[model samples]
Target: MTRRYCSLPRQSVPAFTPGLAAERLGALIGGRRMWVNGTVLHYCFLEADTDASVIPVPGTGETRRVPWAGAREQLDVVRECFREWQDLGIGVTFAEVSDRCEAELRIGFQLGDGSWSEVGRDALSVGAGERTMNLGWDLTEPGGRWTALHEIGHALGMRHEHQSPFAGVHWDDEAVYADLAGPPNHWSRDRTDASVLRKLDPAEANGSVWDPQSVMQFPFGPGLILEPEQYHNGLYPPGSLSPADKEFVLRWYPPADVPAPLVPFRSAPLGLGPGEQADFTVAPLETRVYRVGTFGESDCVVVVFEERGGEPRYLAGHDDGGTPHNTGLRVRLVKGRRYFVRVRLHSTWGSGETAVMCW
Candidate 1:
């Protein structure tokens, strides 16, 4: 059976024995929080003094940064991808064409040796010199679009397909470790375990059909797994998103037929002071959970109120009793209603950073 593995280009090869190479790869790939097998994502918190709470553009006052010389053209590709996904019934909005961070999703490519991105709401935690998404290659390269879509997939909360609990692949562990440790991949045993062998929880399958051709899948040659015939040496190339991929995305982010009742908040770390209040209108959804959280020592409280006939009625309130040490609350919301989320710092602790979102 043939097995496919992630190999480094010959020109980038390092001087090291197979065992040593394997150890290094394992450390680099497995030792951090990741969106996929090899993609590393970091946690960045909003600064204590920032007025806005949603992930802000790295610099102050709407100024933005670009990754490279052709960043403008590259952004077109990203915007088009968002449009494609939206056309397929996904709920996503891309900013108007420009060379800056005027949208919810901002990615700046800096000098780097690899690609990485934060998953979903984690993008809010991005820091300076760090991006929600980062790329080492230029958009003109052969795998540029594939790389963008792949990282964006992570941004959308998708994980590696190989790790799906439903994917019934059997790895030839010995061969996989040997190949990755020897050349381009030079992955350590633990790295190999996390990337190629670890399985996601069964609940993550989301009832969709399993697809080996997913863009999230990594190429593995023969002998890496027990059933070579069943698993193609290179199951799927990194070109277009597979049919299952489309279905999966749509399922998670279906089309929104109604305009949002209020403008979605984009500022990071909505720093609420004592008794401070913020109002947000919840748009229609079949069902949704709203999460409110804090970053510092301030004890935060949340109260959900629904406006009926122009009068406010309290629905629920969360105090320090909730899990995660009383710094957050999870509230379920109904459709097509204007709900106000009042957030404030509890007594004793005067002020701190807070965040609110729904999914």
Candidate 2:
């Protein structure tokens, strides 16, 4: 039997009403970004010597101490995965950081905790010093490598492909629970249900065709899939990212071609559709505090990055999720330094062309 495992990309937010859930999941659908103002995200792992499981085992205080050897292997795989995704030229970029204070994606490798990551920007809501991603199983093996890819997809705001509304997969819930309880997974019934069995709302599925081979898909075993009869025997996603995954990411975060320039104290029309973002290069005249904000009643995510040696570094970000007020970020800007502001519109209410200004 294959040593199968699963990636549980759980939401940081607890259960809520369906309407609110979709509303929240909507932002993630567009990609759970750290304000995706096209900032370069930095990921770091907990020190193998100091960090322990953030979630205590429900009963026993027994926690895992990630082995440095395996953690080292996991780190190499993650770096490769980061470059793989980066090579695609998608809206995302990543860099490894040593300090947790400077990292947005804080990864932990506590064995027995099971593999998982909080979806997208939800990482921000996590406690300042908590693990946002985990790799419980050894990742040196070929099969285990996929877990890193899948969890990173989650961190980028991708949902489970098997749960896609268009997937048309009918799961044998009992069989799923029983199978996951053994060997590689060892997930409890609740974990299985939460990560695998639950179907997503169509709105959250991005209205795309189901791609069984997507890296975001879990490996389904025989007797686990009972629908779409052709796959009834089993469903196995290609261990690597699929073509569909690439296309979807590219479409959502299409290249800016050339970013627009936004002058200080001058407003620029976003003229962006919902789920769309605009990028601008902002060069300040003096070294001082600068404020960037979007006007009009809208839901937006605003992020500012400092251009350093051709790489953009995340500096500040803010999100207004379907709120009455606009979103803004204030930061100290230095003269002779190049900066950029990325603003994504979630939705505009009672208005047309949301505009942003830096002052």
Winner by TM-score? 2
Model 1 C-alpha lDDT versus the unseen true structure: 0.50
Question: How well is each residue in 67-155 modelled by candidate 2, as lDDT tens digits?
Answer: 42235677888888888888888877788888888788888877776778887778777775788888777788767778888888877
Q: Can you write out model 1's per-residue Cα lDDT over 52-138, one digit (the tens) per residue?
A: 223336566574333332356665666566556556656443334232232224555443334565655345345443345555456
TM-scores for all candidates: the values are: 0.53, 0.86
In TM-score terms, candidate 2 sits at 0.86
Provide the clashing-pair count of each candidate structure. Answer: 23, 2
lDDT of 1 at 81: 60
Worst 10 residues of 2 by lDDT: 12-21
Alpha carbon lDDT at 170, candidate 2: 82
lDDT score of residue 284 within candidate 2: 95
Candidate 2: pairs in clash = 32-120, 32-121
Per the 3 Å backbone cut-off, how many clashing residue pairs does candidate 2 have? 2
**Model 2, CA-based lDDT:** 0.76
